[model samples]
Target: MSFSRIKRACAVALFCLTLSATQINAQQKRTKGCLTECQPRIGIVSAFGGEAEVLLAETINKQEYVINGNLYTTGILRGNHVVIVLTGISIENATMVTQLTIDHFNIHHLLLSGIAGGVNPDYKVGDVLIPRRWAQPLEVYWSANSNVPAPCGTPRDLSCLGLKLSRFTSQPNSDYQIPTPNGPVGTGLFMRDTFVRNNSNFPNGEFKFDYAADPEMYAVAQTIAPKLDRCGPKNPSLCVAVQPRIRRGGRGISGPAFLANPDYRRYVFKTIRAVSVDMETTAFAHVAYANEIPFIAFRSLSDLAGGDDFTDVSALFASGLAESNSSRVTLGFLEAWSQKYPE
Candidate 1:
């Protein structure tokens, strides 16, 4: 071939290579954008003490850490996944850490893990309670007399409120349900946070809680869901859904948190119906769900709420077992999630 002809051929090949490079660069830019904007970032929230510490320590990359008063340790677990721990058990404190994690880390998925108490009679010591809805406490006040109304607001019949009632019920405990096209739905699996110990330990050695409503973690989910999913991928955008169960490995014992209840007997059952009676999971669930970050809780039943009148504190420390159960469930859930979201 002539030298001029050869030069022309070389020019054509160069042009094709340039075009290919440009296309590849464009695709890389798009992928990075998705990671920053589209892909769901996950997080975990749990209290410092009790079963939460154990479960968190084992699953998370052990690098002992603390936030505020809450102690936590985090690191890579499964491939690209990362886990975070909250410092303490208070709803306000846990919520604070959760918010910080989402904002600072750009995390989109959040999970609440820990142990909780059983309220339903059907739930055994080892049985779990996946909170379906968080119940909100009615504004109440003492009546000067029986006929007169109480101080806060009159207790209006809330059952007719429909979805609102469900929302309220979930708000207190921090366990939330999303209102989807197909009615309200909870997270697929029951993540245990509360536990029971013995067969005979509640009312008349048979466990029971009074029916009175209050607040817990679902309140956080209700408060934050709108804030998180405002702009993201997943078409309809993701919302928070929580289901907290129990780990029964714990000895039947109640903590000071439960003991602090003014009318423990009357309100315990009522509070369970309205909110997450167990402490830790709701905090994690609420923060992740409300912020539009994806999260799922996996807790274990560690304590029976009724044994020894729920007075023993040491028995409630089934931290090791709780962590073990959470690890198994979380890994399984994540594996399934990867199949659905094969990014």
Candidate 2:
């Protein structure tokens, strides 16, 4: 071959190689962008390690990512794509991790599964309750005592006390007799609605107590009412008196405190009309609402909050059953969800 022809052929080959390299780089950038923007997996969050043990064990193709000291395991769970994570065990922890999960991953829906104290007497140990909505009832004002001329009744009337109910014209408690949202959960603690920002809908926000779960997701949960496992594998002898059932809808409340008092439980059941009470649901709900993502919580009743007239079973005794029950329902819900959102 001629020297000029050989040199020209080499230059042509180099041009083709550069063109291929440029195309590959462009494709890589596009792939990276899609991964960051188009996340369609369900986010399954638990409050503690034990609560998520069953789900974590069952997850297939698990790949873990630790961000800011929080562990997130991404995998396919029960035929649906999901990312499972433990958000610690408090309202603050829940809020922080939920937002973190939302921020870091492309989450289409957020589902929280864990054990909660059954506020309503109707629900017993091992029963699962998926609340229609969740709220933080601990947003209260610790008011100063208003000395109202000697005896202020045995319980000390909240009206007589100097506690103020924000955004409420009349209290929702027995003394007021007015149907309202805000009320005094305790003597000095006056409950009020939480004010949250509109993260996506910038410069606009609302003041409300109840943050509702996704209607479609809630409906799917309601469809599956299978009997839950009443006994744990570790202790076959220890079983709940009644076969566990799943209840959907009604109010669910969350707060910073772990409620174990009978009188307070009665007040929560009667005044708040909450079906379940936990430490993290409302925080997750709040973040889900702010970020405008579909959200739901599956809370298995570990024990009756306050243990009023019921079998005084500690949460410790029922924790295994409750966690199992919650995870079962979560799997059911995810299975149903796959039908609607198959990817």
Candidate 3:
């Protein structure tokens, strides 16, 4: 064969190989995006009793669960790909289980479902607050001149660390909106891993529910998000932080066996933004968002946050059950989201 003919044939082979490689790379990129932004196996982290628990039994499918030493399972509502966990109100415990559920079950899309106390007076027990905005620790300091360790463990992969730092720094306001059925919901930074009760500062020896007396959700998110986001090079972590938009009210608050305590009211309102406070949702949201997993949370109002009245305790307790009724309406929002992206 002539040299010219052989050279022409070699060029044709190289062109074909290039085209095939381009096609494969494109397909891989598409698959990764789908995996990142798809419907997640929904999980609810909540206290063991009250309207949140009752609704779980009523609406979700039943299955026994043993999560991080806790044993309880109310349901497994699939198709929507939901898994509910009753974590009993500790920030550390809730964060661990959330990570466990996400890692073991491959639940990318999560919902931190349950109720919370309301700081906003306009909200009453039965009113719901869906977070559409979010705020992370924006002013964290990394000792200015000293050699700092990687933000995550395993030392800094300068390439990845540089990318992450760039992304966070570029967005001065790292806060994002919570996706919702009606529209976008407001989101905010919640203090977590802290007690919820009245401090001695508020008008009635209670916390004003701000930075001073942080809520558990904020701490939970901080702990859970970085861990999850560090899992892989491709992980996109995002959490949907939510607070129940009313004063303290729920079955646990109202039962005949219940006793009203002023300290509980004053301290709880002083710590968290919303009035009434619950155990689970905020932590779950932090984990979800921090890991770049899409999430949403909204709870029905259960009580009025301020004022003085022990006899009025009965009214406060009764109001918590309102979550049961409102759950029916909000469940649709989650349902529609699942239909669009069945995970």
Candidate 4:
């Protein structure tokens, strides 16, 4: 073969190999984003604009990405590489975005910050709560009024044929289920226990309705509890009516509905023994538990669930300090975590 012809053939072979390799690298980047090797971020999630605004403003080296229509921004906040996701305002949105962030980025930990209703009567608005565990009270089943004979042990003394019935659909799980507080019984409403298995081959997942925040991460929050800001968002001099404080390690619950019923609020506090209740924390906690990532949350009381006396629904929004308090506590947690964990 002539030297010129051989040289031309060699160049063509090299060009094709290089192009094929480039395509493979590009596809890999698109799919996993190099899971472990990619920039590791502490995932911080908020449920709405009011909750996310301050934290998003302070994030440096900001870069934005949209996944499955959810907006996520990656940047360094409080000296930690973090990805912030605005999860709209519901359980489904929170679940989808949290998992999406885990799938697309190297998320080492997950944190949820937002304003929530004070379920614990002792707590008032502007108090930041760090729940040690979370539950989903909204995962429920509405029972039908049963005219059927009350089960074997339901008591024949209480007017046998006319007695209201309360029984578990799933015996084992129901044993641990949160009972309807001060119930009208069969008029219907039951908190059904759900199951979960992070990464198991067990045929039946474990019956679980509560997920705990990572203790190690919770400690960071506890450390900074005393240092959190208690000032107003607009005017620092104008503080909350009750001095804002941070309380760590209690329970929190999430459901689709905004908790505004005083009776139910009392029930939640009594039954789940929750300090705060909102729409996103439990969803985020559940996802983190499944992913085996460290998770924690900061929720500030906006109002007294249904105890607030307001004339207009639209006018009854949380004071700016409520969200600011939450965001500030979250930032302090992240900064403390960055030091404790060191990437």
Candidate 5:
């Protein structure tokens, strides 16, 4: 019942298919911007507003991009194409923003600049430290022990007793043995998640305990370190009795705790040999390592982490000075790096 009807039906079907394809293409374009080669850019990340503001001030031709409630600024800093963002103040926030930055931008390198508590007595207020490696000291497993005193000759130390720990059940089981006067005893164990990322540069099947900063960047930072100012108008009284100098190539640790206990500070210094401690760098470092991005961190000490007093000095006056010193060195690094690797 008719050639024209059949021809019209075929034409209608063809038109619908074409329209569907067009809509699909449009949706894809909307969801993900046009795929193209991304310009090489460096990422400058800071933990909080104070840390970020210093870097922001150095940016020229700056433009802001708000994605998923995080602010990213793209601009030219010290003659390099760079994007800067703030990763709030904790591990969770730091991790989230780091991955987001890597996913959404063409970041070739990452630099985390911020303030930290001085762990190494050699480092004092307003001293900037560029640690070669970063780790989370708080990532551990705890063993439970009863208050009951150990039998004589059984050893009074809880760690010297063999105890089956309960935490980290999902991780591979291992016993931590601590030696005492009695003998090596099995305490609780700690094992980093080995399956986090599979990278040939890292130990296979083992989550790396420490993430190293790019050595090339570290070298560059060292050259610029001397030019940074140790004292500033923000806090002249808090300046180190001795001239505050930049310290490079040391361990930096991060944790959730706002560390201010003298005993814990001593423990951290003895255990990790960390020169500086902060709350965000290690988390960001971990993410960067997983993504195989080159990273370096510049942390200025705002106060002695319980070496001087328990009161929080970061909020009092030293924060600005720390930020200034760190930013100064960061700018110097960028300028020197640009001279070496002109874009």
Candidate 6:
């Protein structure tokens, strides 16, 4: 062959080889259910449309991935790589999507931001809370009969069940003793379940309930709390009468039911000592705990959870304010976290 022809042939061969290798690597990533470069990134989740919209607005260099009809966006938020997703509006959806995200991405930290019902009397609408721990109030084994006698030496109070109906009862010894600065405080109506799973950090067994948020993330949130804007200027009509504030170090509870009764709200507050109630946080917390990932949540109060006479006002007016406040805090948290742990 002529020298010029030989050189051209060699260049063509090299191009074909590079193209084949690139195609093979792309195929492999798809088959394994991962991105080509699964960079260690923070995972951000929201359960409401408003919450997700707010976060998506701040995302830059966005890339979309559609898996099983669920949309996930990866981008830079607050100068950190993050994968943002919406978990829909229930515990089942939250658990499924959170697990899916962890399975497909190299999630270094998880942060959930959403609106919640105010469970504590001290928290007003639009206030944001970052609870140190989250629990599922609906995971209960109810007693078979209403006639079951209360434990001896204990008061015959149905309020301990944390439900309005007196017929429902929890096991006598199901209370969880949570350690506090003051002392050990007993809360909840069911003992935490121990699950044996290979993928979990605790292979032998570990409690699935009362999942605690990462202390470092909680500390970062506390630092950003004062800097956040608590009052709504965009929607002044929906602004809370009292100036909203960021509250840290409280218990957050989740259940399937939307609590709209005064009795139930009071019961949850008194029994669980919870500041916020939502439908999704506990499931997200559980999955994060099982995967041994550092996780935190910022929940803004949309309503009193049945404390106010205008029950419909929350969904009609206060949701936007709550979402706005939570999104603001979430952005602040992300900025602080990225600065503390720069790439």
Report the number of the highest-lDDT candidate: 2
RMSD of each: 18.7, 10.8, 17.5, 9.6, 9.1, 11.3
TM-score (C-alpha) between model 6 and the true structure: 0.74
lDDT of 6 by residue, 107-163 (tens): 889999998888888777667899999987666534433333343434343335432
Question: What shift in Å separates residue 172 of candidate 3 from its native position after superposition?
Answer: 22
All candidates in order of lDDT, best leading: 2, 6, 5, 4, 3, 1
Task: Report every candidate's CA lDDT.
Answer: 0.40, 0.75, 0.41, 0.72, 0.72, 0.74
Model 5 steric clash total: 0
Off by over 4 Å in 1: 1-40, 48-74, 136-276, 280-290, 306-319
TM-score of 2: 0.77
Model 1, 201-232: lDDT tens digits are 43322111111111222222222211111111
Candidate 4 regions off by >4 Å?
1-37, 145-186, 201-203, 226-231, 235-239, 310-319
Clashing pairs in 2: none
lDDT of 5 by residue, 68-180 (tens): 89988988999999989998889889989888887777888999998888898766666778999997756754434222223233323223333222222223223334455
Question: How do all models score by TM-score?
Answer: 0.48, 0.77, 0.45, 0.75, 0.73, 0.74
Give candidate 6 regions above 4 Å deviation: 1-37, 145-203, 226-234, 311-319
Tens digits of lDDT, candidate 4, 1-343: 9999999999999999999999998886565532423687788888757768788899899988867787788889988998888888889888988888888888878888887888888876677888888988767544443233323444212233222222332332222223377743442355545556665626555556688888888877778854544556565654555566787777898999988888777766766687888888888888887777888888877777888643221222433676577777887788888888775
At residue 90, give the lDDT of candidate 2.
Answer: 93
Residue 130's lDDT in candidate 1: 35
**Ten residues in sequence with the least summed lDDT for candidate 6:** 162-171
Q: What are the per-residue Cα lDDT tens digits for candidate 2 across 1-343?
A: 9999999999999999999999999886444312333455788999756768889898899988888998888888878878888998899999998888877777888999888888888888888888998977677654433222112453334334533344431343332122236833335445556767775656755567789999989888877756588786556666778888888889999999998876667666677688989999999999889878899998888777767444535333543666677778888888877876777
